[model samples]
Target: MGIRSVLSKPFAAFVVREQREWEQKAPDYQHKTLKNLVSKASNTVFGNDHGFKDIRTYDDFKKQVPVRDYEALKPYVEKMLTGQNDVLWPGKPAYFAKTSGTTSGTKYIPITKESIPNHINSARNAILNYVHETGNAKFLDGKLIFLSGSPVLDQKAGVNTGRLSGIVNHHVPGYLRTNQLPSYATNCMEDWEAKVDKIVEETIDQDMTLISGIPPWVQMYFDRIVEKRQMPVKDVFKNFSLFIYGGVNFEPYRQKLFDTIGKKVDSVETYPASEGFIAFQDKQDDPGLLLLANSGIFFEFIPADEYFNETPTRLSLDQVELNTNYALIINSNAGLWGYSIGDTVKFISKDPYKLLVTGRIKHFISAFGEHVIGEEVENAMKKTLESFPEADIVEFTVAPNVTPEKGLPRHEWYIEFSKMPADITAFKSSLDSSLQKLNSYYFDLISGNILEQLHIIPVKKNAFIDYMRSIGKLGGQNKLPRLSNDRKMAEELLKYKE
Candidate 1:
């Protein structure tokens, strides 16, 4: 083993031990964190406006600060952009994480000096946790690559600004700098397809062992590698053992990714956002992600079913129950107060607070009160795939077909398939049946004849990819939504329908 590898084992052990200590005291740590955040930011503009000085308990904090989405918080953000200090948190923000917004054009989430460590260290600890558990520090000795946005950043109000991935690229620790791959120049390429080609050229001949990115992008890299090398990715990178991914659920792409790899490898699932790194898979065998409770964010949960209600009940970490879907709310050290990042999660285990990212709050189909979520669709597809071994998908999205030219209202499934199933009718039937079983509201709607059995629209190969490119969101942290309530996406997708 090299010097770094020899040192990593002990370092990993220390980090894991520290994490375990905090994990056990999560509730207490969370309470202290909230108190500290409120105390520190009380004199800042946001804290003053929200009555943070008077907050003595969770109830006080909740009463003072109502949950806010980006739109609600935009006024303060606008002020920040005007070079205002102590607007959100005390002093100027260290960086602004630029991300695409749906209603609002582009969102610039602040990354404060105090909060950057939470982002950097959580990612590091995830790998360290893996090393500590599996005794696999050998990957550190080989080249590693993160398929990310151009590290080259722009300035907004004299503060460095760019995509979260790009901003994070600047903070990659010194130890891993020598092992990180694709070169700085290659990563700065704005064209994602061209960047992937350059990345393949750079890493194809190297000793790459650890690869990280969103699943679809990583799959594209693998496909390109296979095409160029005329061999599976596993054969090309023999020591490649760890596949780290975040931003989207991996279940839908898992079968196709492994098939392309020609072998299974250890994988780590992470829940990262421009707002913060929320959770990551701690155990290889475990199903859910370990929530970073003690990390600089204090979490609250609003019941997903009641999220649209006038007065939704918000629960603290200790108050959350297992298997119930809740919209995640956060009050972070980064100066975000009661911010909803739009993600919905379900706690599978409460003792250590491990949860599954069930879906998004806005990304659901409730056209006819069916209220089907991302998790239901993903799970249904995953289960349906088990019976159709020959069928594999590239990308897919669900939308409600309220007014079809010739049929009753239905949920439209626009799918891009790598390999079509032998029995198209059977595959559609299985997918529909699986969805109905998973969502009782949808089942009831189907039985009542309010909505017809879901219709599958097989899209032409590379249709989704082409669509993403058209929108200028082909790669990096961008993700294709699995579900949409309206037909905007579905209508555009019909142009590519097979």
Candidate 2:
């Protein structure tokens, strides 16, 4: 038997137990889970005010707690962050994750003792599920490199505070830590450039079998390794076969990552936010992730179209329909109650539920009444890129040119290309054409002569990296926004155009 089999038996059993409970519990699992959570927290301030103890049904809970975004919940979070206990959860938070924010400067998200297992275990199960599906457990016997953030944390108001990955890294179980690469000293370096250099120095000669990270950052590591070894990734790490990734839609970086690996390998996707562990791609053949209903969190949905409305309708799991875009609201053991995380998703299956993350509720371009979403915009770019095999894109964002450009208002695309395309104008036209076909509202605006064709702005290399660095958002779950309704992002990008 392999070392993995001898060591990971308990984890293997845990995955089986979770899967069995998910299947056997059937349709009642979600309601059962939510009711239990309410009963547990009924004595807390949030729960007591919302009448949690008296609530026995979804309708009652719905009537009591109002949906809230980050700004609205800031007051309670602040109290909790100031060393106060039981502000949201049963007791004090074990740690807090710092999320990058615009208006608020920085958001310190709570990470309670009760919620760490959900994040860490679900991550393990994602990899285990892939192993189970393919019956390939040998991959675990070799070194697995996860390009995770720092593990060392600092105190904020007497509570440990850091990035989500760093917080999670500190809790990695002892057994699993054996095959994981990079020493603790190297992992905690604050400067990204210095941290990456150390990581390359440590792992360049290891017997690596799996790699994982957000695609763009992973690509940076791959590029450096290739430059150092004077060979492709296939030559450097012959044992590597699986890549696990998250944090952005993978389509834009798919070809680039594939080209860098220089060979085919299995991949698995996961949806993990600081708020909760939501879903994971559970099967090899299925694209959508299996939403975790029994993972210590209660789920609710609101129609995306009505989320910004004065009286939006909230739906239970039973009320959700396939193909409808709905904003996700979460309540978890981590002390979040009826929180709108701003992510929107579409249901793909009813029984043993599955879904696709559609877009963010606040991030989109609708300046011309075209109502374009992130998925539509990203897919259009993907299709257009497919036609130009020789070209590759590193990063891009779309924004509205509300000011008249010569004679008309249009969408402006800012792109940074690693390898330039032969015909730039043709590439831009193809992206615009695909979008028009995908979105009827956008097509009608063009057909009615209300808007001009999209504008493509080719940016200099490292534009995104430089922009993020200037704002101190260069790495660690911090991503540049894709679609904005106004010229905020589009116009600001011109600063670095020089």
Candidate 3:
């Protein structure tokens, strides 16, 4: 390695050390501090304007404050947009992280100066934990590539602010920044159609060792690289060392990613949303991802199965139970309090508050009243993949097609493949059998004849992206809807004749 590379290692080590100290101190100190912060913010925003007199205890805060979604905070966002700060967190909003939410539609989530620290610190903890797990910080001295969203954000006044990627881009230590690619990928111009070309060109010859992004987008990049170079993915990514990702579960794409690389590389998972950066994989052996408890937020967990009608129980860091899934609720200093972000996670342990993301509670199939979660679906897919090692399924979606005339509801599978199955009939049969065996609900529904049939629709490699593009939704952050729970959306996807 060159002298520049040698010098970069110590700087990275210093960052890791600072991050470790922060992580160690956070869980212990955050709860009380965050409660105080929330109380102060509540007083500032709604003390006189609204009815909230005070928010002292956890129970007092929960009972007094009604849960607010993105739409509920529109006025606050509008205030910031107009260059005024009338809510929690002082100073003008730094950037709005664009998020594609399930119920709320596309949202421009406000990221203020107060909120930016959470994102930065959570990301730093993810890196520090990676180094701690591998016992090395200099595992990848080569170029670090982030397959991120468009760096530029379009503003109403025609003066564009930087996107989250651009903000992070500016913050990265100048010494470590790579010259292999442009400071910013310009091809992601005003139009979304131009982004793929830019992404493809920038990633082609770069000797990238570390890559970070959502799995689907990264897979698309690899596919494009393969097509352009006319070479196997192994040749394109021979120097790659670490695969860091967030925004979605990696289990579905695990086999494909491994196959493309031709070997195993360290994989890291991050639990982050436009709302805030939450947790990250702390130890390689442990299934639980460590929560960034200290970052200007008070974390709370409500039982995953808890309904809106029922009074939800919120667990503090010390009170959280092991092995039970919970819907994450946050009361952050950045303005959101007792907010239901919609994602569900299960605790692996609570001594240090390690968690495993189960899935979005909204994303599930309940055709015959059999609530099939993301974990069950993931396991079922893994079992089916294990049975058919020869098949290369790229992306898949499941929909519950209820036929009242037939007196049953069945699951219809839409799958995209890089290579066609030689024994298509047998593959389908095996998948059905595996799913039935894995999930008791599936088995009972099939055995009881409530689920009449399983239909598999095969599509071209890029069919899903084409579908997404047709809807004017295509980018790094956007994903092909996994389990279309909406009846119309599910029906439309299932009845896709093409």
Candidate 4:
């Protein structure tokens, strides 16, 4: 018997056991999670102010902790940044996951000792669940390459601060360290081009069976290897059978990614943010990820339409309905108190409460009355691409061309393609039609002659890559923005093509 045959039994038991247990206790899991989180964080400053000692139920907890966005809780975070104790959690946070903010520079999210285990466990469980479902553990005997942030981290307010991927690397168990590629020395190189070159040089010959990374950056790695070896990925990594990805919608990049593989491979999507690891694709056939209902996060949903209202309606798991879009609110062990993480999701199933991350609340193109979200834009692009099987989109972004000087107000698409369609005008019309069908406001605006036809600007190849590299967001957890309300990014990208 192989090493996988020996290790698979126990791994399957741990993963499947938790999944089934949560499924069995789905309805009451929220209550249990809330009680544990509230009881644990009751002595902190927030707890004292909110009277957490008397808070016994979800209703009481809700009343005590009014749903807040990051701006509302900035005071507490500011104090914590100055090395204050027990500002949000029991002690100072162990690490801060600094992500790009919606309007400004950076937002520091706490990652505490209690919170790290939950993140690590969820990630571990995701892979284990896959192994249990497929009965394919031979990959375990080979290398697992995680294209991630730099190993070198920066210190902020005496606490370690870095991207989530970098922070995660520090905690990888000692046993797995032997099979991991691109050593710590290589990871320390801050320049993305240098790191990718080193990673390809190091991993091209290794028995890499599994890989994990965001799609675009991973695509860069595949291109490099193929260019170097003058062969497909299947030829170079014979045992490669699994690829895991997250941090952006994978629909547009799916075809390009699979083209590099040269053979079929299984993939799973995860909904992990600096706030917490929210969901994972547990089963092979299911499209929606099963929410981590039993995790420390207490989930709440506000109907997307009412999200910007003075006082929006909040719904619990029982209160949420299938097929409804919501702004996700999370209160977790990381001490985020009823914090709206600014992401939107839709429930596809209500039994065990399965969901799909739909879009970011800030990441929308609402030039007119139509609020075109990330999911809408992505789905529209997917539909348009179906008509042209010969073409594949490498990267694309949509923004408003509002200047009267440019003729009329309309959404402008900046797209980079691996294979350009023969009929460019038809491609643009089809994309605009698909979008109009998805959003009524967009359709009405066009029909009423209030807006001009959507414009498609075919950008030079590698424009997105050059832009990301220029901005120092070419690797790790960073992603290119897909939809913007303004023309800043679109204008900057036009300069590249010109």
Best by lDDT: 1
Candidate 3 residue spans exceeding 4 A from truth: 2-27, 39-43, 47-53, 101-105, 135-140, 156-163, 180-187, 190-193, 404-407, 420-422, 433-439, 490-498
Candidate 1 lowest-lDDT run of ten: 1-10
Candidate 2: residue pairs that collide: none
Residue 373, candidate 2: how far off, in angstroms? 1.0
The digit string of per-residue lDDT tens for model 4 on 1-498 reads 466546875878777987898866676887788888889889998889899999988879878888887878888898899988887878999999988876546889999988897788888788888888888778877888989888678998899999888898898876577788889998877888889999999999999998999999999999999999998999999999888888899899999888887887999888889999999988879978888988788888999999999778888888888888899999888999999998899989877789998898888988787899999999999999999888888899999987757677999899998899889889989998999999999999999888888988888878998998888687878888889999889988987662
Give the Å shift of residue 214 in candidate 2.
1.1
Return the lDDT, model 2, position 191. Answer: 82
What TM-score, computed on C-alpha atoms, does each candidate reach? Answer: 0.99, 0.96, 0.88, 0.96
* Order of candidate numbers by lDDT, starting with the best: 1, 4, 2, 3
User: Which residues of candidate 4, in runs, are more than 4 Å off?
Assistant: 1-5, 404-407
Across 1-498, the per-residue lDDT of candidate 3 in tens digits comes to: 655545545655776667566556655666676666665565455433443456566667667766666677666666666665545454445666666665567666666677777887677557666765566555346677776656666673222354566556555556456542434746246444466567678767877777788888777777677778988666886777778898778888888877776778888899887778888887777767877776777887788777354577777777777877788887776666667787888878656667888877678887677777777677777787777787777888888777645555678778887665778888778777877876788888888987865777876656777777767667666666567554665455544434
Give lDDT per model, in order.
0.93, 0.84, 0.69, 0.87
**Steric overlap count per candidate:** 0, 0, 0, 0
Q: Which ten residues in a row have the lowest lDDT in candidate 4?
A: 1-10
lDDT, residue 469, model 3: 76
Model 1, span 1-498: residue lDDT tens: 887788999999998988889888888999999999999999999988989888999999889999989999999999999999999999999999999999889999999999998899999999998899999989999999999998898899988999999988999999999999989999999999999999999999999999999999999999999999999999999999999999999999999999999999999999999999999999999978999988899999999999988788999999999999999999898889999999999999977889999989999999999899999999999999999999999999999989888879999999999999999899999999999999999999999998898999999988998999988899989999999999888888999999
> For candidate 2, what is the lDDT?
0.84
lDDT of 4: 0.87
